[model samples]
Target: MTEDAWVPLALSSMIEVGTSAGAVVQGQEIVVWRDSSGVAHTWEDRCPHRGMKMSFGFVRGDHIACLYHGWEYDQAGQCRYIPAHPQLEVPKTICVKTWAVAEAAGMIWVALGAVPPPPAEAEVTALRSLYLDAPLAAVLAALPEGFGGTLAGQVPLVTLDTDLGTLRIGVQPIDARRTALHLTVAGPATPDTLLALATRSDAFRLSLETAGAAA
Candidate 1:
């Protein structure tokens, strides 16, 4: 067993009740989704059979049925039905791996290893999250200390910012050269302003990279 942490997976809006957010945490492919009952669930992205992606499967209330074979699994990642073998209790080997998951501040956080307690949301106001092509370092640099202290309303961050020792930024790798930076601004503001800042910063990052490439 290794030391584990619960990383913010996605913004609440990105994952609808019937949709899933695909992420790779600590090198493990994971799919976090919400069922029809309004509960969030996390499981390995791969199916036990034929390595089909379970994230593509459809949700039926509390169960997730594989899209390819219609095999169903429960919240506990237990294989509930085989479709073909409707009356038989599927063995454990047929189940997909799962982990403890919870929602915090309108976003879902999933632990990769021994999961910690669900994140408590007290002052953390749900702010919009975005996908950035740049790395976390670049994203932080672009911000003016949380964008010139704009995040006054957000609190008790779902993610722990180890670098700043204050608010945390949830950073996920999209590729060797790119990362998705999910950051929470302090609180309420003009959505138009926030969007403009994000957009401009992204454009600047692209320009910087292009300049670097030409050198």
Candidate 2:
């Protein structure tokens, strides 16, 4: 994906409130977190203080504290507190790089540069995010061979019609050699059906990886 493109990082259900997780988009590390009020934010995963990954930290109310030295950053990515130097006022320049974030179609998206028109709003049932040890192009090419769904939409966002329902999938390029697919159902589905779809996806992943290894 281009630097300006909005990349879907994770499934919306994956990052619970007051929780954070590490993600990679085209090789760039990012931290996805939600505050107490349930607003999601994305930022550079590295801490400016000691280069530690902010994903290793814990969330407190609306702030996320770096595990290294208890450096806390608010939802705006501004450093708000330092445990070691309680009386020291943090500089305005001390902050993490923030990204534009949005939630739609059961996925959390992050824009690396200028935000484009947001993904069209739709009601969807959250499924699961699938990661594969294969290139994005390869994964897309092999998708039809697996689920045999009628695929539609541009890259990074697509839909596949299956027996269960229409699957709204968000694609993510984790790197040159890895990709992620955030899936959600557009129509109602029972617990058993969802489990079956998930289980079938696991078989698809195994087959894809095995084929890549053989090739």
Candidate 3:
């Protein structure tokens, strides 16, 4: 993935304050966590120390600690504390590589490189993310015709006008063989409408996955 493109990692509501979750983009593991102040950060999933998955760690006020040895890293990805040596000052060299993160359109996005394009700015209601085992190209090819909806725009972002409402979709390339669709309503939608959209999305996922397996 190019550093210039911003990829949606998770739904904003999904990653609550003081929590962390694992995500992958093009096969690179990433840890997405929110601080007590509700600011989100993304970093390499590996702990700088013993190479433990940072997503398996716990979150303090503004720090995330690796579960391996209680190694705490501040929001800046700098190791600020070492429980093994409380009195010893932690080395500044111990820090997890971080990526530029942004929240827009009710989703959390991470830019792989330094010069990331602007995040997608749109007023939309969050639906849910759909993970599919099929290739992204196949999913995109099938989306317009499958939903009985009018599809517009291009990959990475698109719009589908359905009977319920217009749905804004952010395409995430999980890897070569997997893809994710971050779904949101383009405008105001009632809970019933959101539920219906979600159900329809689930059916599409099942159909795509089944066809991919057969292929």
Task: Assess candidate 3 and give its lDDT.
Answer: 0.88
| Model 1 per-residue lDDT tens digits across residues 28-139 | 7888888888888888998787788888888888888887898888888888888888888688777888888878755677776787777666334334455655544455
C-alpha TM-score for every candidate: 0.75, 0.98, 0.96
Off by over 4 Å in 3: none
Give the per-residue lDDT of model 3 (tens digit) for 1-215. 44578888888989999999999988889999999999999999999899999999999999999999999999899999999899989888999999999999888988887746677688888999888897888998878767658889876678888888898888888899999898999878899988888889888988888888888
Distance (Å) between predicted and true CA of 36, model 2?
Answer: 0.4
Q: CA lDDT, every prediction?
A: 0.64, 0.91, 0.88
How much does candidate 3 score in TM-score?
A: 0.96
Top candidate, metric lDDT: 2
Residue pairs that clash (backbone atoms under 3 angstroms), model 3: none
Please give the lDDT score at residue 71 for candidate 1.
Answer: 89
Model with the higher lDDT, candidate 2 or 3 = 2
| Cα lDDT tens digits for candidate 2, 72-184 | 99989999999999998999999999999998878899999889888777888888899999999888888876866888887789888887788889999999999999989
Task: Give the C-alpha lDDT of model 1.
Answer: 0.64
